[model samples]
Target: MKHLSDNEKDTSRIAAALAEDLQPGNVLLLHGTLGMGKTVFARALIRALTGRPDIDVPSPTFTLVQTYDGLICPIYHYDLYRIEHPEEIFELGWDDALADGITIVEWPDRLGSYKPRLSLDITLSNADNDPNKREILIETNA
Candidate 1:
C-alpha cells in the first residue's frame, strides 16, 4: 500500500489502520532517513494496539528496544540505529521478542544477512516540495 501523509495526523491515521491487522509473528521493517515519519508511524501503531490513545510511546533510540504488553499481542519496538553488529540484537534478548511478539524494527539495514522469513517493509520519504509532507509505502515479502 502507498499512502500520502499531508501531515502527522494523516500518518497516524494510516498507522492505526495498519495496526488493526497485525499478528503475533508480524515483523515490520521501517526504513527512512533522519527526520522522516518512521517513529511517528510506529508510535501511532503501538498506541492503537495498546488501545490507549493517550499512552506514552517513547522512541527506542537510546534504549534500543521497548516492549508493551496487554495489547492484542505484545509489541517489541526496536531501534537498531546504535547497533554496530547484527549480533548485538542477540545481546538484547531479541530471540525472546521474535518468538513471542510482533517486532517493529527501525534502521533494519543494520540486520545485514539476518532477515526475517516474512515481514512488512515500510519506507518513508519526503514528498516533493514539502518537507513536512511524506510518501509512505508498505509492502510484504514472502
Candidate 2:
C-alpha cells in the first residue's frame, strides 16, 4: 500500500487505520531516516491498539524497547537504534515479544539478520523534498 501524508496528523490517521487490523504476533518494521515520521506512526499505532487515544507513547530510543498492554494483546515497541549488534536483541525480550505480542520496530535495519520473515514493512520518506509531506509505503511478507 502507498499513501501520502500531508502532516503529522495525517500520518497518525494512517497509522490508526492500519492498527485496526493488527493482531498478536504481528511484527511491524518501520523504515525511515532521522526526522521522519516513524515514531509518529508508531505512537499512533500503539495508542490505537491500547484503545487509548491520549495515552503516552514515548520513543524507546534509550530504553531500546517499551511494553504496553493492548486491547487484543501486549504491545512491544522496539527501537534498535541504540543496539550495537543484532544479537543484543535477545537480552531485550525479543523472543518473548515474538512469541505473543504486536511488535513495532524502528530502525529495523539494525536488526541485521535477526529480522523476522513474516512481518509488515512500513517505509516513510520525504516526498519531493517537502519535509511536511511524507510518502509511506507498506508491504507484508506474510
Candidate 3:
C-alpha cells in the first residue's frame, strides 16, 4: 500500500493502521535515509501494538537491538546500519528473535543473504512539495 503523510500525526495514523495487521513472527523491514521519520513510524506502530503510549521507543542504532516486553509478544527492534558483516546479526541472536517475536529491522539490506522469509517492507521518502510530508510504501513478501 502507498501512504502519504503530511506530518508526524499522519505518519502515526498510518503506522497504527499497519500495526492492526501485525502478528508475532512477522518481520518488518524499514528503509529510509536518516531523519526521514523511520523511527517515528516505528514508535507509533509499537505503541499501537502494545497499547502503551508511555513506552519509550528509541532507535536501536548503536545498540543494534532493543526488546520490548509489554506488547502481546516481544517486539525486537534492530538497526543493522553499524554492522559491518551480515554474520553479526547471528551473533546478536537474530534467529532467536525471529523464532520468538515480531522483528522490525532498519537498514535490513545489511543482512545480505540472511534475509527473513516473511516480512513487511516499508520504504520512506521525503516529499518535494512539503518539508514535513513523506511518502511511505508498504509491501509484504509472505
The number of the candidate with the highest lDDT is 2
**Top TM-score model:** 2
How much does candidate 3 score in TM-score? 0.94
Model 2 segments more than 4 A misplaced = none
RMSD of 3: 1.2
Mark the 10 consecutive residues where model 3 has the least summed lDDT: 67-76
Candidate 3: segments with Cα more than 4 A from true spot: none
Instruction: Kindly report which residue pairs in candidate 1 clash with one another.
Output: none
Put down candidate 2 lDDT per residue, 6-55, tens digits, no spaces: 99999999999999899999999999999798999999999999999999
Please report how far candidate 3 places residue 111 from its true position, in Å: 0.6
**lDDT on C-alpha atoms for all candidate structures:** 0.89, 0.95, 0.88
Between candidates 1 and 3, the TM-score winner: 1
Candidate with better TM-score, 2 vs 3: 2
In the range 1-142, model 1's lDDT, one tens digit per residue, is 8989999999999999999889888899999998798889999999998899998988999999989983767889999999998999988767887787889999999988886868999999989779779999999994
Lowest-scoring 10 consecutive residues by lDDT in candidate 1?
A: 66-75
Q: What TM-score does candidate 2 get on C-alpha atoms?
A: 0.98
For each candidate, C-alpha RMSD in Å? 1.0, 0.6, 1.2
Off by over 4 Å in 1: none
